[model samples]
Target: MWPLRQMLQPRHVLPIHFDNIIRINILMMQVKYCAGKNIPFFAQNGGSGWAALNLTNGIIIDILPLNKVTFNTDKTQATIGGGVSVAEAMAAGAAAGAFILTGNCDCVGALGAYLGGGYGNLMGAYGFGVDNIISFNLVNAEGELKTVTEASDPDLFWAVRGAGPNFGIVTSAVIKSYPDSNLTAWSTALVFPGEQITDVVKAVEALRPNLKPSQNVFLYLTNNNGPVILVTGFLLHATVEEGKAAFAGLYALNPVFENSGVLPYAQWNAGAASFCLREQRKPGHSVGISQLHPEQWQEIWDRYVEFRNKPGAENSVVIIEIYNLAKGRSIPSSTASWPHRDVNAQAIVIPWYTDASLDNDAIAFAQKVRNIWKSTETKSTTYINFAQGDEGLEAIYGDSLPRLQTLKRKYDPENRFNQWFNIQ
Candidate 1:
């Protein structure tokens, strides 16, 4: 067997030319183990918090090399390896004349995204990523491989759709695909004086209900030396004229910088990615709320302004993303382990700090903002995907706590795969 010392080296240093040598060494080492023995392994791709948690026990499955995905010609379904990235899946789906519900971050893993309750630009038109999955190829805690679907092992299937990672290791999944449609997406930015925060909120409140199922609107409160209001809207229209007409009302808000036109699906996604790319000044954090009341919005806005004016709060940005809930709300609450489907709106606050000295202050500020919202009767919920490592189990699970705990008892009584977003 190869020396364990060599395997302990950092994987990032492995050269492409020496990959064959490494693979051969691994193959030779495997021969020494017994046929039915189940050896623990480490699994991670992008090394984000989502993946790093798997290495907590120092034993991960290391599924990054297993990346491979295929889509059928019928456009009915596609199977993706656990390690596949959102970018990789998008390219493959485009080639196959189909697409699946995926996140905006191209680096997010397909399995990790869905298992964590994936939300994306297209979620308003489709649904949560977990809702589209048809089946899963899972390796249970006992090292037994099983194919789980609605018709077979219905309970496990339901759990896997939203609560899989907490139960077992999901090696891959087959998800429903939609026929590729050429889309016309447009973007517009309005910059109002910082003092007009109330006006901006009023505009958003008026526009929220008018948004069509095929459109998505996001508003960001930012400051680069000074405060500014920015609004971006995307439409999944079949024609440029239709997109223009659909966005006319919103555009009439008198955007300072507007770029509205037709683009291919690939271009639209790329543009979306570019707009979302922000400097990694510090450890990023966010919070979620199920609904946004007008009074709550005003209170949150006041908090944001106050926080921005504080010392060492220059680069921070507060983002607001609004998408149609018609599609997601249509699904039964029990269809998946994901809760909070019936809420009208969702909001998240993201703040940044450069120096370690300011880290505590930043966290305190975020917590204070969260507390302000929770203290009210809103009882806002948190999305597991955006959760910081320290959030409580009840906060992330919401009303589905009992069902998730029950699945934990059945599939992973020993808690072998309990690293990622663990219940206990």
Candidate 2:
């Protein structure tokens, strides 16, 4: 047996040289070797995953070397490397006068989010990140590199889009892009008093049916120096008047603090920069809901206030992401493995602290907030990317769980890639 210290760290790491096809293929073969020896291996991306992962006595494949983003001549499609961040992709798209669907944070791994059914500001118009994937250059469990497209291999394609980490390592992917000569969005940040939680929730609910394809919004109960309820709204390709008209309900609330402006596509995720800080203990609990209940949201605000009062946990946050689902729902549900097409809102409670002693308290607080949201949900569902790992296969995979299990057996029978939300 390996020494405890050595076992705690990856056995090997080939960082800078692991970019090309030859190196990627060799890495896959090494993965197969690890599987044969009953040793574990993991692919490390932007290091944004908050799940508790066990990589002891395993190989950590640092995919950062594969960071490359290249767009086609017409700027309609771009190939994104596995290690690329959402910010990098957006920067590349902005440079090319195009837009690609990516998550809200600047530091999140592009492929990591895309594989788990990507959610972003552009999702209101373009659909989820998975919907834009043209093809994936994947190295499967058996050490074989193959190109996966809907037509090339239907089941594998479907399975990978939602549960890619469970099956293989995606070296790179070709994704659809939209060219916009004017790639700017009008965005606003609003702050409300804690007492206005019910009013804020009601405003969001009232605005839901009127949401446009170019609009999205996020509500938060968080600490900005101190506890405050915040709302961030985005409208793509819109002027100040157009944006204000679209989000009239929120404007009517008369927030205590407000900042509104137009931002380039590359700077769209700037507001989340503070939350993108790495190396802190941030265990997140999230759920999907069909409707926003004023009472439940008020309760959530109360719970957040209680938890945020904890000395070192002031940064903890409760957030609800609301998107226009018309464009995304227009696509058939069976088109991919993402199961929450019917969900109208996604909520997450992030309890952030560095003290190991606060683990139990934080977990309890997050779970309690999640329970409040779950009470309003008719079906238990969560976006895989937002899942907190203990939600079980059914919660993350939804109706796609059974079929995914079959594919897992056929492809990764020994469960080599079992780190993130493993398919059991």
Candidate 3:
């Protein structure tokens, strides 16, 4: 039986990590063995931990168990199995007195997220998740496993950083890690009543530069019975007092709620994860922008207010994240296929719909807002990680289209791994 045919039948299944290429081979052999007797089998890794999986037919190989972590004593590099979660990677890095740029959401897969240009709270300080990746152990289109690096396969390495899933399945990744220190981090939430959006915007803009490199600020617009302003920011410093002093200007805004303090790195990671916990069933879409001018903020605010007034809009959320980009853009654009290297802010408009019947209208509303933002004079770029499935490839790649396409054609002419945020 062919690989595809054996994979399609449902039979005894095994749950192993994607990094365990040997196990995958064993499972394949098992399937072949079963096929000899005309039996059917299938497997899957059903947790939300996977960043991306083969939604098409065939056996679903669970890569979560293949998690094995190792690190270099120099503190500049670490190796992680593809099945490792962002939280697991962080924990391992912390244990080694090192850290890697990762997403705030702990459940996201490390390899998949990093390869897909993952960004998170530390992005302002490091860069996209892909930037920290040094090399990868990948299973190519032909199932021949190989180690791809900047020197070994320059083009393939470049493509893998931003678009790896398109070329092949990565078994493990060797990534650059940062020194782990007891960095002081705090979260501040400011509240402004409905009519004070302009003031809030001005205050945020004013505090932008004052915010140290260790800080991340995000704006939340919601209509939970009434319009309110919530500015949540994280200040990373050597000490809690220092972080507080550095972000004093923001706290001076007299937020309705303040929860700023110091905690262990693990606790901080957990806190960050808590903020992203929302109902998964709610229809949602997100788009990131390079930057938004003050005038553009007004237009966005107006649409936000309009959406708030629409029926079934009570749970709508419009998040505007203004984080530092100096660290991320410091790397030359030519170094990787990932774009949005110079973006300073990311705007995500999420209009939630609880009723399934209202899905079409809710999606239309989200698209309309996205279109308005895309048509703006700001000329911002879209972040591939947050992009919705409906968006065209051109919209995501923008100026980087030619290079990405060239690399895509060269590495994945057949496009076997075209599952996530595909270029085509």
**Which candidate should be chosen as best, given TM-score against the real structure?**
2
lDDT of 3 by residue, 19-62 (tens): 46566565445445434553322222213321223343434446
- Cα lDDT of model 1 by residue, 299-391, tens digit: 666667776676666656666677787888788878888776765555555555444466566666667666765665355566766666566
The CA lDDT at 250 in model 1 is 50
Q: Give the candidate number with the greatest lDDT.
A: 2
Q: Pairing residues by index, what is the TM-score of model 3?
A: 0.82
* Per-candidate TM-score against the hidden true structure: 0.81, 0.95, 0.82
Worst 10 residues of 1 by lDDT: 1-10
Residue-pair clashes per candidate: 8, 0, 8
- RMSD per prediction, one decimal? 6.0, 3.2, 5.8
Off by over 4 Å in 1: 1-42, 49-57, 181-184, 223-226, 238-241, 244-249, 271-290, 294-315
Give the RMSD in angstroms, all C-alphas superposed, for model 3. 5.8
